[model samples]
Target: MDAGSMKAESRCPLQEQFLQRKNSKENLDRFIPNRSAMDFDYAHYMVTEGRKDKENNQAMSVCSPSKEAYRKQLAEVFNMNRTRILAFKNKPPTPVELIPEMHSSSASASSSVQQAKLNKPRRHIPQSSERTLDAPDLVDDYYLNLLDWGSSNVLAIALGSTVYLWDASDGTTSELVTVDDENGPVTSVNWAPDGRHIAIGLNNCQVQLWDSTANRQLRTLRGGHRSRVGSLAWNNHILTTGGMDGLIINNDVRVRDHIVETYRGHHQEVCGLKWSASGQQLASGGNDNLLHIWDRSMASSNSVTQWLHRLEEHTSAVKAIAWCPFQSNLLATGGGGGDRCIKFWNTHTGACLNSVDTGSQVCALLWNKNERELLSSHGFTQNQLTLWKYPSMVKMAELSGHTSRVLFMAQSPDGCTVASAAADETLRFWNVFGAPQVISKSAPKPNREPFAQLNRIR
Candidate 1:
């Protein structure tokens, strides 16, 4: 017969069975009688066979399938087809204990997979955009004062009696000193550059130096003053603190124990304090509206107790002062008065160079180490930041953001960013290449009655 005639005449039910089987395991001999099983991806078929091949460690590859195999097994299994046996249908699943290591592909049909999504841990965020904010933030722990970047190892006196030491390298904090009920909210804290020790100023005219490396409070000088501790500053080896008692005390940290020296000068509460960049002198400001520069080198005998120079132009209490790290003779002082303004003066000559005016009371002053620009914050007023050129005191730009009050400001060591703290306790950062922007606002009192009421009703 011709090929066309043969094609029309040939017909077999085998082709129908081959077309329907999911695994297509109808035995190739029933279709292409001469084909070998090697034509298939045997590794794939063996894995999908849903059968165990125990004899051949590797699954069937057109080879042996001899685990308890042969005519006897065939005769015994002949009575029951796959559907009648039913053991494979309701087989107990792979134990939950063994599922962790299994990485089943998504194409797999078995919904019985018990794999845990541990490698891709899910974050606890209700909103898709909610991020798991880390505590050891890149900049959150960087503490700063008028003197320097309080950005390294730091300590803070909080809740009156709680002395908290924080490693600024990362936000790892611990309550190191708890001074009973007599303690008031800590007004000042300082960490020596070496990070070996920390000094905390408490409300009760006391300066306590604690060895952070030793993890113990080393000593406390009670004879320094009889008033509430208000401000403290320290460098690598010295501690200088001024308090409501109007006394300035310098503690030598070089000694194993704290050695305290009292400088009698400011007649009113000393509200601001800073050490000279070279550590040769100490400057303290008082409610007397005076900035007194003390010759710290005069720690010797009967030297008359008085300021080397007194700056009395400021009519109100000076709140902050920044000593230039590059030049000890140049300094800037800020105060709160009827009209908000800051006074920049020469420490050596007591000459007022410029008086900078702000829309509100100035809370903090930050000087750029590399440049001569000064950044200041106005207490809770719009457009509170005044960035000005030094000496000339010309306004460079005004930064606006804090809706409540800008209480503190610090320029990063590199001057790439500036951090401003507000009465809102919200630390906002600004990029100066273009202009400063307000990112967020956090109230200092997070759990206050207003917030409490909102949460309770919610």
Candidate 2:
């Protein structure tokens, strides 16, 4: 053979190597892991791998039917068919705007209109206070709960040594009682469920039960704490009190010997206290940054009662405590300046459900009696009241006006108005939560009544 015949018959060494590598089994075949054997994110894997498969399919004009049948068979054996994997009978319909050619000219206009609808607020929220009243001598202390609104359309507030009641029905303000210089300034005030009865916690470490209807002092209960009493809650006739000495006491006001159960948990001043609507659970927050949920059935007159759940997640003092009116087991709590976050809990399981940073000290939290919305009062930087949508925790509105930190908040009986007291020495009322929707009379009520457990309290 001559040189010309050899050159025409053979190729370059580099070209031969390239051709061999191109048709190699290692380059053509890919390793696909058994997705069912390993617990990987199937959706993510499908999304990413599906994109690669589409690119490869586009690169090559020919597809092997036998190889495709093999993949389908593997998917069926593993019960991982793409459509059946997510258990969807059909794919979701694509939004009209997503498909462009159908309405090419009006596409931009239609999308903008849909965007406007989505961005609109669910309901209108007033940006200003409906009414403002001067709160002279109102205590500026963060740990003291000095304001409460009774269900009788009456609001009781402590100013200096006197306690006053403001009627929401007729817009009348009346003086309830004035303490002597020895017992002087009031620390906390709460109205009983009866609305006619009210409890006043004093600086002298005493809790006085009063009759607002007759304007008379019913009785004085003592020996609950060594320091000033700052928190009080009522579960039927049982009056629960918390003081600066880190003690929680349950007093049965119907009997002469009132101290029935003592909760021994907090090491710092107990500043916040609330009872569940069902009256089975009691939640308390303290200056030590701890929250404890106490079971009423665990109460013992023979021995000190222990807490059911001791939550130590707060980085600062927790003074804001509120029970969900619609959910008996759900509780909401807020931390102070050092920890500006609102946390939710499941009282039954003691699980922290959710937490949201409010960017300021949360002073008090209140749930709308008729709706799932929540209103939170804050301290520092704007001193505003924030209305939030539950579950989502979206800030619907920020009602601002107070010049100082809002220390206390109380809801009215109708759940329409909120009364907030700030260090600015003014009490402002905001109609943030809209009027509740009226249900039809023929509507079926739930078969279970959670609050019916209150019958077993005494």
Query: Which numbered prediction scores highest in TM-score against the true structure?
Result: 2
**What TM-score would you give candidate 2 relative to the actual structure?**
0.71
lDDT of 1 by residue, 267-354 (tens): 7888788787777777787778777888766665354456688778877777677887667788888776454678777777778888
The residue pairs in collision within model 2 are none
Q: What is the lDDT of residue 342 in candidate 1?
A: 81
TM-score of the candidate numbered 1?
0.57
| CA lDDT, every model vs. true structure | 0.57, 0.84
Top model by lDDT, which number? 2
Q: Model 2 Cα RMSD, Å?
A: 25.3
Clash totals, every prediction: 6, 0
Error of 2 at 413 (Å): 0.8
